[model samples]
Target: MKNKKWFGLLFFAMFALLLAGCNFNSSEKSDDGTKKSGDEKDGEVAQVLNLSAPADVPTLDSTKAHDAIAFNVLNNVNEGLYRQDESNKSVPALAEKHEMNDDKTVHTFTIRDTTWSNGDPVTAADFEYAWKRVMKENGAYNYMIATAGVKNAEAIMNGEMDAEELGIKATGDNTLEVTLESPNPLFKTLLSFATFLPQNQKFVEEMGDQYALEAENILANGPFKLVSWTQEQGWEMEKNEDYWDTDNVKLEKVNVFVVKDPSSGANLYETGKIDRVKLTSALVDQYKDDKEFENVKDSGIVFLRFNHNNPVLKNVNVRKAINMAIDRNGLTDVILKDGSTPLYGVVAESFYFSPDDKDYRELNGDFNKGTPEEAQEYWEKALAELGQKEVEVSINIADSDEMKKVAEYLQAQLEDNLPGFKLEIKAVPFAQRLEIEKAVEYDLSLSTWGPDYSDPMTYLDMWVKGSSANRMDYHNPKLDALVVAARGETDLEKRYEMLLDIEKILLEEDAAVAPLYQRGSAVLLNEKVKGLVIHPSGADMSYKWAYIEE
Candidate 1:
């Protein structure tokens, strides 16, 4: 992940410069049967709409996906029973209706008649099988721990029961019932996650353990079907004419190209080759004057991760010192010229379960305001405690130009602020950086997290005990206990209290991670595009409701 503060600074700078002289003009009307600039034609169909992103989709398998790029792709091919809307509220997708028992432990779902691309009738059994596979001990699903409801789910995942006995059950062909050990307040939100999406049991059994191993084996039940994926070239999705709500789908095809370079993406958008492109700091200034450049708020948190297992980073004082040294505001103002906001807490700013609640913003205190004097004091204390004459650390970063700028800036800041401290920076490709992080081979790293669901737990629970994502091995028994308690507490007030306490402890006392900022996505879209919805969770591209102007 690039330094979000810097990314924000760069974006803001570009936005400020662009708005200075640009006219906020209304979209022009189109004629001659072609779509008008920013206006949709009355009866035209977009044969293909091209889109671009910084990162390539890491995996097509929803169970194994842990990154935003993968989620963007898998969301098109698979969908859960429920989905989060623009307001971050849960809404029905595959399920027609649902009810909760008195105790709220049992959930009965009435699924709509939907079929997979392979022509298999989707049923309750499919959900059951998919849930069980994820809760299995060796399941590849990244958020499988959230599957606390399946029969013997916790026990089976913990190696105590047979994996086949997990809690999901198919009462009938179209009816499904799930029994959780306790009431899960975020149950509906969890259903919106990719891990809970139903899969074809027969298909998985026939393919063995490698089901959905490639484009050929996968099945889609969403609005679009995967037409083809040519690796590095691009992936194509055609609107599923067989979709249950096909009448609402307007785009005939969605063509996505894996453009890693932001400059090239901006150029493509300018030339009208692609319908949308993501603008980075490098290209923000050049296109800020264009009406096509639209600023989008993304619920993403960029931060620095310390390898707690590393001998050098294992020192709490050292971590705290580093956190106090960086100028977060400067990074946000200088590096990111977009609408990025500096973040003080683990959760991103304005992120909350309730749309009306402003508690997260109010509770977020300044933890990383760049106090060089305080950082120097802590550095001296850390050096003395370690019995070392000097302190040195290397930060492993991604190979993107934005990341390189961030790493260099941090190196200068840390080295200049604290005497006898040396900062070394290493830039590596994303894949290589992940391998190094997995091996606990780096002292510090740059990373970001986009929510898997619309819950605070989605951001906080990754640090819980036995979590695969807790690569740093940050052991906070009290924090772990609080997270576990919050999971079972259905009362909204109590859960909020628990989360606030956890955040305070993690941000103020432990300094587990240094949060940089919350980012805004700059997506340049053609005037012809209409009904494009941007969800806060950054989950699916809801092109079903989207239509190209005719």
Candidate 2:
């Protein structure tokens, strides 16, 4: 409750701003004159695909990118050794073939001969450099916790040892070997993450800290090479002629624009300026009858995170009560009309490491369906323990139109469900919200999580001790112990059991965070656009296979 009063004041200030005016208009031009009829004319480049995202690119550095926008951009510019297909099966990308030792402690990969966009050979040393840099930099990346193969990675990251002592090594120019302290069943899946992506060591050193700050400093080893980036305008990528699998590549160019306003995004798509745009609630009804509307299950999940370090929210009963009070179904149905499904757990239902399993659902049962009576019971208990006659809670949220609706709904629900309790809502810009969350400046805040890798541990390990993403300061010794045990377990069944146990503790006892709903994206795409692949992880635009119809 330390910052509760300040949070309340900020909430009112934001609400006043919202009342002043909210307008979403499109400034992009229509592309009616550029439309073609059938197939691409000989020697002509394929169609120029225009795509828009709700958020701008957060960071170009793979190690620092923790959001969807940056991941989408990285997909066009970088490739991991392995790729996770739609079915969650691991397939080769930079690695043509691989073999594991008997004990599974060592993995040998046959690196495909590839060149960076700058024409430099992509060697095993690149991977070694990236792995060590992430551990040494100790930035915002959580790779060490997600990928358990690197020996002493945690200690090295915590300043206990030099990064050079890390276990990954290059056997030869084309061969690479990684030594893990113990067997990791999901090692291949973890490689799909950007944090594990290889970097050009020479380029990074030459550029110093500004290596990935712009399109010119970074080099691409993937299907597309970043050609240009216009801040707040858009980013463009062209096919890499030197890509190993260039024959299979489809699209020639991909243009991604930052269209935070849904109405404007829809307008841009309708006018043919953009190939695809995400739909908002206000426009969903309008586009429901349009044949071009396409909806897919989004892999992102939204939740409420409490600042456990705060004096008021530190109480277990208060957290549990708040979680019980939320009506997730209503939030999804009324507030977010973009086809999101209420989640009973943190992981998306479609997400998987192996083809047949959903890591989170198999472990933790669906999220708790909130009830007023249940919330009231917990609220009374919390009040008694705190010896307070009245309670007031403040929540911080993103200033997006959809998010504001959700926040207002929560404020009403909490006040009506729990007597003698008052609620305040603060809406700030997306970047500002992130800054405040990092500072731990609010009692409660709305946050989201998207898959960083294919494993359940990607979502579960965020709250592990001393993790940068653990903004809530939620510490559980048993949970921490299970996470460690699961990381080293080679047996699939045992590893799963450990993960399931951790999820059970989090949902049943710890209640460290509340699961809201799994997000779904609705896009408006021009009929001419083809070969577009939407991965749940939001990486891999797959534009190489796309061509414009003449």
Candidate 3:
């Protein structure tokens, strides 16, 4: 689960980072696919738009979705209680307005009269049904247990309490009330997230196991609906005319292609086949001078996750040696070529965890960045303890151009820095990589996590013992205690401090996962496309407010 927190990032295998060009300011594409000078709104509203995506969406079911591909599509096709506006503010969406009780433990929402793409009226019961469904025992939704702040949610998911007893009710057709176990400051903002989005009860039941498997099986109430989904190839979305805000939606159709090749995506953009394409590091130098080039800042971390169950990786000295041996500076500055910074800890600098505006990373200080001498010391000690003069480790990564380069870089770094070490690289498709990680079938897996929300806990909580996202099999009861303490603490200052300590234990002591770099993308976009939501957290991108000009 990239998002165990409301602002969670994705973690899987292979080219895990959404490494591409950054956010765009302005530029336009001519008919021949070349760049042209143009204003924000150069012509009349265009009915069709084309874009390139890195991969195909694995699932469309909001409850089961855990990747950027699925979430990006869901962001446009499903309306939540609130939606993140272009400025990243939580603005009213399905719920016209909401009010919190005195203690902030209970909230009442006044939902607007809306209709799904299939013309069924959206109702409060739909949201209630959706929430309960995800809370069912072993429902496998990434964020269900993470949302235990909702009263009885944990108990229901644990099967100790019935889903019907969860603290959510439809006081009226247009009225929805939710009671929380405690006051969560991020609850409203969490509503804007895809995992918390509404689903149609009647429609879901009708489709049963087939729900959201394809275009025809899904129901949408957002600005657009999934009209066609071709697995691996691409998908198409059309504006939902039944949407309450149809008048504001400019593009009638959105054509998205799953272009896994960076060079292919770049060519598509140059030829006017796609309005936006993520740039690979190999092509960043070529496009860096282009006016349309965008170096968008990302709020995520890329790391090397060790499967602790592996006999070799289970050794603390071995894990520490691997973590220190890598040259993160070289990777970020030279290999990535984007603005990504080397991370010494799991938490990114973008997060301000304390009330005094102190960054969590700074608080934890730097961990071991291995010099040749230091790495040798740890490696020798590790081998001596394991009774082996040499070792071989396998790494699993996504089969993208950028990630392939990353795996190669690591292979070179580790083999050169640590003696008696041989490395094997496995490059597989993005979806297959995720399956391998979930099954804990690899020795070393390159992973990335985007903050599910703005809080530092989003980054820190992933490593806690027994967490759904903690596929590493790494556990420290001491670190787990800090996480639990932070969650239950009402005082902001104390909570933030606890989080800082937790990160220290994870990176400095246990080396549960080796820090790689903060995730960011260098992207190219047509200036004619306006109002695309490029957020720092949550879903990587959203097109709900986007429109194209002629």
Give the TM-scores of the predictions, in the order they appear. 0.88, 0.88, 0.90
| Model 2 per-residue lDDT at 458 | 72
Assess candidate 2 and give its lDDT.
0.74
- Output the number of the TM-score-best candidate: 3
The C-alpha RMSD of each candidate to the native structure, in angstroms, is: 7.2, 7.3, 7.8
Per-residue CA lDDT of model 1 for 1-550, tens digit only, reads: 5798798668645643432232211123235432233323465443455676665565666666666766777776676788666465778888888988898788899889878998888898888877776666354453454544444665765678876776678999999998888887667777777777887877877877566556676788887887776555466688887777678667677767666667666655654556777777667788788777778777888888888887767887888888888887777668876667778877766667433475565765576455899998888888888898787778888787667877887888878887877978888877577667767688888877787776676678777656766667788999988987887777787778888788877778888888877887666788777777766774746666666665
lDDT, ranked from best to worst: 3, 2, 1
Off by over 4 Å in 1: 1-47, 137-152, 208-210, 353-356, 368-370, 538-540
Which 10-residue span in candidate 2 carries the lowest summed lDDT? Answer: 19-28
Question: lDDT per model, in order?
Answer: 0.71, 0.74, 0.78
**Which ten residues in a row are the worst by lDDT in model 3?**
15-24
TM-score of 1: 0.88
Residue 512, model 3: lDDT of: 83
